[model samples]
Target: MEYMKNYKHWLANVKEEERAELVALASDEKELKERFALPLAFGTAGMRGTLGLGTFRMNEYTVARATQGLADYIKEQGKDAMERGVVISYDTRRMSYEFAMKAARVLAANGVNAYLFENVRPVPICSFAVGYLGTFSGIMITASHNPKEYNGYKVYGSDGAQLSPEATARVVSFIEKRDYFGVPEATVDPSRENVMGKDNVKLCDHITVMGKSVDEAYFDRIAKLSLSPEAVAKEGGNLKIVYTPLHGSGYKPVTEILSRMQIPYNVVPEQAEPDPEFPTVKMPNPEMPDALTLGIKLAETLGSDVVIGTDPDADRMGVAVRTNKGEFVLLTGNQTGVLLMDYILRRHKEKGTLPQNAAVVKTIVTTSLAEKVAASYGAACYDVLTGFKFIGEKIDLFQKTGAHTFLFGYEESYGYLAGTHAKDKDAVVSTMLFAEMVCYYKSVGVSLYDRLQEIYKTLGYYAEKTISVYFKGLDGMEIMANKTKALRKVDIREIAGWKVASTVDFLAGEKTYSSGKKEKIDFPKSDVMKYFLEGGDWVAIRPSGTEPKLKLYVSASATTAEKAAEKAAALLDQMKGYVE
Candidate 1:
């Protein structure tokens, strides 16, 4: 009844065109309830959902309401915050540009300056612009790697990181008080040509359209992050690469960076341009193997040794390298993270640029091999919760205290950041670094695959597998919560014949050992569980923060790759049994 009431309210308030869409759904009870049973959740990462006319879907009204709440929060910070403005950027998703303009206009209506981009941009650049332009905050209109039906809103602090939990909570409090239809409309039409930055156009009082200058500064900063320019100079011309943006926002920037670095690369023409439909791929996510099929085929045609794919927002990257047998194999996120870490550290050490306080950060679900690699180079590795924001927070902390120099940060989901220029995972920089890495390895007569094998031989084989079980429909959230709750109550002693040495309940912020000793986990409480086995193996179970699924991650290490793979597979299978 409440959902029905909300649906009717939305249908009545929306425009004639939007009302038609809702009217069509009136007869579909399931669809109506799915779209109105709850308001699209606005967490620290912001909200994401289907594009439709409902309380739970993303639309002009929803974007406007969220922006109004953000404006209120900025107003709390005072007039200076209003003058500082907020950077706004979007990808090529359907209505992405419209949603971005809507947010900009809403912020402008609330008397907050909105520095909207002239055209589409990726997440990293938006994050970078917050700090680069001295903005009070930043907003990115993207769903990252989600399907085409979904779009999202991400808020960033002045530090260029996603808002902290406390900050997000404050913003949400203001957001909850606002009525979607009551938010004030834009006082001015800033979308006109005269409002743009080009042709010496005079910007409006509350809105500024940003262009090339921000990108130039961002590219310049990324160029300074190249550790092996000489290697790139030597092998760049010969080491051909195939890149595919998967019809998202990565095409221009990814190509421009490779050209700047003088790296020889080919782009899959079918996916070289921005298409909101993402026609060439089922999902615009690089983490999915099918997304790279075009890129890999082009690689084979061009005799390229590497294929790189960036997601819809270009915040995450995935790679497939040619092996010794002349076969292309996709590298898992864990493998890519470790390889990049090893390459960065080794190069820095060779050039004597490696800081004595160098450090790397990875999510708790990431491969433990990073620790072994970091230690081999006399660097420290730290684990954080499963978000790039935690990594960004650490980068901010390192800058304040001088405790450690942040070298690199990554999660197990193909997101990576190498430079402090952008506080979020940057596929632009990651693409640049990986291209340079391939060149660097080629200069030493080693393929990327061979180097990976060598690292395994030295550090011992490490295998990691991640599996997600979906829970669709309105009951998805409730089911996932109940499943995690049930798991928390069970004392899992062993999994796949591996003894559980300890179990960590992150929601309770406690790690209980088999010896009956309990230690507090010095991290924020989250609905997550991690088990440490007899060996250096680990398995983590947690509900996905952004999607309707429970994710299980397992990592197993052994003297050989086969054994490690087998162990990891078994552990993952057994872990699934516990949840399902």
Candidate 2:
């Protein structure tokens, strides 16, 4: 009866186009249950769901409801907070612009100012704008590399990082108190309103436009992260690079940075423009090899030395470099992170800029090779949970304690951040850094692939892979929960012929050794299991927070690359069997 009450409200109020879908979906028992069972809450990421006509989906009503909650939270902070206002931006996804406008109108209706991007922008820009404009908070309308049928609203705190769990919980509490059908929103035509003009829409008097001013400020800050200007000056002109935005919001910033640095580069013509449908790729994420197929093809056509692809919203970057055999191969996220960490640290040491208290942060699931690279320069490395928000939280902690100087941060999912310029991952800075790193290596008469191999030889060869098993639709959640529950109880004594010395269940926040000794894990509780085996090999399992997939992570370290590969592959195979 409660679901029906909400359903009738939506069916009565929603636009004509969506009414048919809502009426049809109401008759499907399974879908209706899943959709009405619960509202979308903040996961490891923010509020993300498939696009459709339900409380579980991301639609105009859901966006408005979320924004109303945010507005309430902001107003509760005080008048000064409300006056400080909120910033809104969107990526190039279906309904992204509409959602952004809806958020602005909701905030406006609550007497809060809104600074909206005039055009599509990246995720980092939203983060940057939060601090740059001294806003109360920020919202980015994006699915962030999800499939075409998905959209998300990511909230950023005043410090320009994704809202911490504590903050998200607060917002969720406010949201839970509100009625979905009764969230207040002012009527505003985003297309008809200009930042400089008087508000034609109710409560939009405070809306301001952030355009070239914000973009320039963001670019200026990112450009300062370049560590190898001399290398760029020497080899920038001849460096043949091909870039693709995957039909998202990175084209302007990525190309602008390269051109400003005087680096010669070409864009994958077919993918240079923003297309909401993402006509060229199956998914917009660069982590998949196929996401860069068009970019790779363009690179080959231009005889480029490297190919780089940025996912939608431009936070994650993937690289494909030419090997010694003239074959271009995509580097895994671990490989890319390791290279960047080593390059950043090595260059910092050479320049005598290496802080004694310097530290690098990575997720527990990321490659352990980062620890070695950070340690080689006498720097400390810390591991957090998977989300980059934790990394940002650490940076914020360092800023207060002065115990550690933040050096770099990365995740295994092709996300990396070099400077504290923005708390979230910044592919704009990463693209600049990677470009400079490549140029520097080329100046020294070595290829990017060669440099990677050198690092592998110096620091014990490391091999890693993440295998994801996805379950779709209504039953997916149950299947994943049962599998993970069973996995938690499974008795795993050994893996890949090596004895399991210990196992850490993050969900339990405890680690138990083969000798029966137990210790508490001093981190956030997550449904992740990590097994430490003999001989520097390990395996981890966790469900993806943003998608309907269970992920298995394997990391193996050995004296030789071949041995490491063999060990990792065997462990992954065993884990796959368990997951399936």
Candidate 3:
């Protein structure tokens, strides 16, 4: 914390009105300590924290430090590195613009030009820009679905994915070892401002600050991701669809793409605009049905066939489909992922484009139906560690060898990617695919809800549930860490009504096969416990990487939805007692 005590001049160059705001934050002991406590560590999902004055917080100084480290690393690569500048964009979070500018200034000060977005942008757009502009890296100021109290910085590599572990760790080492906190207040102003002053910075030949052109590129890309552009053009008028951005940056790009595809759709005007407060919804998450209640209501009133929503940054997506029973039912994230997998596989197989080297990737926590889908088509299905980054890594591997063509990738958290263009979960592409898929189903005189039932009948009916127990504050992190450790020591594993068939301890990187063979599991180390049970039911336990909560993932199969859901709910209830 003392490392930052001397850099008091950070953010000092702001206008007088903003200077007063910074002074107020500095004067508040709690805020200053929160901001100065520790450097904002980049966790699995990138850097996120409550915005304020602390080193542990998201602010001008922290962004500068991170940017400075990034710039240092880039410049150290040699003279050619100066030609590769970074692209920077921000969302609607309070002071996101100022923070982004601070980061750009730091990069500029270090001789790394930053193509700063002059306006708010969604996360996927930033990902698209990194690849489109051929930049050294990309920076997005967003907290995704987190509450308004928080903001974040997501770093993207040239391939438009999060930094690989090795690269990120190197950056972390740079950040931790630097005397970032000790940089004098007097010099910080010019150090940052001078970077943006044109003398020190050099823009990449292709890396320019783009606003609408990138959006159009994404729209064009999403159009190609469509399953049936012709069908959408033919019967799009009959396809009634409702989309809500949850009051975030998804509003503009999505609208443009849908219009370009000639797909007729209605936007929930109340939630169409980018409002960081997410006014229409209680919480801006489609995974929570409550978050989509307003959109659902609007869809119902419009008599739309389906409703879809994107998170604040438009990476993950939540959707609503009318059930077989003629009522609105929110599909779980696993359900949506599996359904998309089936849709893609089914379409490709029918079109004779199903490659012998086709591959589908999914997180282990996601539903097992993806396994069935890949097997049905004689394609390979790979289960990655539980995060889109792992899936993106798999894509990177495939891109190198052409051993397989990427068919689809998803996690059970409303994140999916079908095309190879973007490495991360892309709500823009997913949203377009969903709209096109709905159009396809409409052309066949079947609803998406009905198509899902057909999938269940073919692929064994699968049910899944997530149980979360909150462990808040610093002490809470300690307790959760301990509890996760304790689970690794337990021997007897039968739970609720299932017999443990095998177990995978991710923390220890061990998996005991039911065949009595023990093998090493090679994935990034995570504090996770997974047990596959008898009769195809499985359970996974892990603490939420982004939040202070221990989470349980349960998946089961049955002959019917009633049985599957019943068994899942009961087992989840029993597993509740295990949380510390």
Candidate 4:
């Protein structure tokens, strides 16, 4: 009944095109109900949803409401905070720029200065700008790697990381206090004046359009993160790397860095430009095989040794390398993480810059091979929750307490970060590092794939597979919730014939042993469950905090490669069966 009222409200006030779409949706009860039944949920990662005309969808109304809430929170921090303002950037998704400007306008209306990027930029740049400009907060309008019809609004703190849960909760509380339709809307007249000396200063009174000054500052810091500059200088001209931005925001920064480093590289021309429709790929995500098809084809044509693809906002990256067998093979996020981990450590040790307190951070679901590689070099490894915010949090914590020195951090979802230049996962930094990595290995007469095999040979062979089951519509949410709840009640002694060593419930913050003993897990509480099996293998299940899906991750390690792959596959199948 309330949704019916909300439907009428939108039908009366929305744009002509949106009004027509709403009228059509009204005829379909299921779709109408799904769109109007609830407001889009906001969490630590902010909000993501399909773009359309409803409270449940990502439209100007929803974006405006979120921006107003953030503005209100900023205003509450007092006049100085309001003056410091918020930085805003967007990727190349439909309405991304429009939504970003709308947010800037809202903040401007509230007497808060807004720093808006002149054009689309990667997420890490926005993060860096937050700290660089000493802004109160930052906003990024992107759906990340999602399909074309989707867009999202992510908020970042002054520390240049995604807002922590407590801060997000406060923002959500502010959001809930405001009416979606009643949020004030304002306007901004953007100009492209080349203010060289004042590139990042406010132009029209309240909103500033940032220019090359910010980019140069960000690039300078990213350049310092390179572990092997000599190797890059020696082999850069012969690296033969191919990169694709997937029609998003990575093109400029990614290409700029590659060229500046003097690395021989080619861009997949088809996806080099910014296209909100993402015409070349079904999904702009590099994690998918099809997303890299065009780039891989270009690499093959040019006899390139490696291919790299960045997602829409350039926060995540995917890679493929030419093998010694004269074939190209894709590397999973886990493989790439460990390869980089091993390389970073090896190079640091060789250079005598390897810190005695060096430590790497990864999510629990990531490959355990990183831990092995870290241990081999006497570097500590820490596992955090799934999001890169936790990794950023660890970085901040390490800086505060000096308990451990943060070296590198990554998640299994193609997100990686190095150095404190940017708090979030930075594909630009990762892309440059991978090029240097490739060039270094090539100088030694080996491909990245061969180096990966060598890593497996040195450490135990590790294989990991992540599967996601999407549950759509209203019923889907309930189904996912019930399944996770039921799974928490399960006390399985074995999975796919492997004996269980223990079960760790992140939600309860406890690990239960087969003998009925329980010990508290030191990590933060999350809606995740992990089953540790014999031989150091494990499986984890968690509902996606940002998407309408349940994710299952299975990681296995064995003395032999074939056995590890087999065990991982079997564990994944068994976990899928349980969820179904």
For candidate 2, the lDDT comes to 0.88
Which lDDT tens digits does candidate 2 get at residues 148-249? 998999999898888877878888888878766777776766566644332223334766767888888888988877888999999999999999999999
Error of 3 at 336 (Å): 1.4
User: How many clashes show up in model 3?
Assistant: 10
Candidates' lDDT values, in order?
A: 0.91, 0.88, 0.77, 0.89
> How well does model 3 score by local distance difference test?
0.77
Query: If the candidates were sorted by their TM-score against the true structure, best first, what order would they fall in?
Result: 1, 4, 2, 3
- Candidate 1 stretches with Cα past 4 Å from truth are 189-203
Candidate 1 accuracy as lDDT: 0.91
Residue 214, model 2: Cα distance from true site in angstroms:
1.2
Q: Is candidate 2 or candidate 4 better by lDDT?
A: 4
For all predictions, the C-alpha RMSD in Å is 1.4, 2.2, 4.2, 1.8
Per-residue lDDT, model 2, residue 298, is 84
- 55-125, model 3: which lDDT tens digit per residue? 67777667777776777778777556656778888877677777777676677666675777646777777
Native-to-model Cα distance after best TM-score fit, residue 80 in candidate 4, in Å: 1.8
Across 415-452, the per-residue lDDT of candidate 1 in tens digits comes to 99997999999999999999999988888888899999
Highest lDDT among the candidates is held by which one?
1
